[model samples]
Structure formats: C-alpha cells, structure tokens
Target: MTRSAGLSEAAVTSLLAGDSVALEGEHELTHRFTTELLTTHRISDTTYNHALQALGRDEVIDPVHVIAMYAAQAAMLNAFDIPAPETNLPA
Candidate 1:
C-alpha cells in the first residue's frame, strides 16, 4: 500500500526490514514512531524528540493516531475471532 502510494519498492523493503536509514522524510519519522509505539506501548522520549526535530507537532501526532487506531481495530477483530485477509505483498 505504501509503495502503491508512490514510495519506491526499496523504501518499502527497507521499512519492512527495520532499516530506518533507507527511509526518507515523513517515512523515516513514522517508522521510528511506529516501532516505539508497538514495542513500548508509548512513544519514548528519544523517539518523541527525534520526531519533533524532524517534523511538526501535527505530523508527529498524525502517525501516532493512525498506529493507535489500527492497533485498536486489530485488537477488536482478534477479540471477535475475525481473521485478517491474506495479502499477496512480500513479507
């Protein structure tokens, strides 16, 4: 989906592989924030600081909101025993 949105295949692959150095612009910040959010359940001070330095407050907030919303949706789906559809995209 990200690549279809215009990111290069290399960018998508780098993100999936957890290689932040290969990402650029908002993609880099979002990747860092998402990792912190998923692993810590909250953005850490270091991640928050880096985001503030690289993006505006709203930019930082947007990805956090997106991640949280999707996480909540996934939790609800799992609670109801709903299986996510398989995608043909590379893992």
Candidate 2:
C-alpha cells in the first residue's frame, strides 16, 4: 500500500488523515474497484459485507481477485449498457 502510492514517510500522515486529494481519491477508486471485484468472484454481497467486518477480516484483499470479480460484473453491466449504478447492501 505504501509503495504503490509513492508516498514518503512524512507524507504518510497526510495519507492516513486523507489530507491529500490523491489519498481520498484512492478511497473512491478502491470502492469502485472492490465493488466490481466482488461481483466477478461470485462473492455474495453478504460475503463482501462480512469482509468489511472488522472481526471477519477477509483473507483476500489483493486487487487481482477483487478487480477480476468487479471486471466480470462490469462486463455484465456493459452488456446491458446502463448508466445507473446499483446500490448494494452489506453482505
């Protein structure tokens, strides 16, 4: 996470506080990326929500699986060509 952002130690505090626009931007990107990931992995909404649970702490957080799942979902969405975003409940 640290290396990916190209942030120095001094910049970490800002990232943690989300003082930097790019850090907050990462959050938004992550949300969308994770959303697509879950959909593609066939991971149920309930499972995804559970992963968010501090207690559950899913073993999988890597973008490969998450992004693949989401990309699959995106493909489905693209087939439909809908502009609207689907709201989901916690798994």
Candidate 3:
C-alpha cells in the first residue's frame, strides 16, 4: 500500500532519498514493512545502516537501536489503534 495522507517526515525522506529514516510511512505500514524486511536483522539498506555507522566519535550508537526503537514505538501506536491523518497525497 502507498502512503495514505499522513505519512511522516521519516517516510517521505526514505522514498525521496531511497532510504528509510526517522521511521517514515504510515505507522502500521512502516512497522509492517520493517518487520518484513528486517525480520532477521541483517538488512543491508544504506539508510538503515547509517544508524550503526554513526557509532562512537561524536555520537555512539548500535545499528540495531534504530530498528529496535522503531519497533517498540510503532507497536505502541499500533496497540492504541491510532490512525494516520490524511496527507493529500498525489497520484
């Protein structure tokens, strides 16, 4: 399914940049997509990889953090049955 009206900035950034960031797309859509592609945690996508590569130095982090974070957050929203708003998306 395409981005309904209420796609998040993160989702827009991903499609436009050809990468996923900030957990874009409709909450359920984004979460489901992530679950499918990242079920095993060996995703090779550049955008997702960026999270891991930014470890130590100025900002230390684990790549899995991004996915893990999104998963928890997305699940919470899903649990609440919060629907996305309309974005007036183009055809």
- Compare the candidates by TM-score and give the number of the best one: 1
How many clashes does each candidate structure show, in the order listed? 0, 7, 5
Clashing pairs in 2: 36-70, 37-66, 37-70, 40-69, 41-69, 45-91, 46-91
Please, what is the TM-score per model?
0.78, 0.29, 0.34
Ranking by TM-score, best first? 1, 3, 2
Q: After superposition, how far is residue 35 of candidate 1 from its true place, in Å?
A: 0.9
Positional deviation of residue 32's Cα in model 1 after best superposition, in angstroms? 1.3
Find the 10 residues in a row with the least total lDDT in model 3: 54-63
Question: Candidate 2 has what TM-score?
Answer: 0.29
Candidate 1 residues 1-91, lDDT tens each? 7877667888878867867677777777777788879988988898898888888788887888889899999999999999989988677
Candidate 2 weakest ten by summed lDDT: 51-60
Candidate 2 global CA lDDT score: 0.54
**lDDT tens digits, residues 14-71, model 3?**
6566555545333433344355456765544553444335333233233246667877
Candidate 3 stretches with Cα past 4 Å from truth are: 1-37, 41-61
Superior candidate under lDDT, 1 versus 2: 1
Each prediction's whole-model lDDT (CA):
0.82, 0.54, 0.53
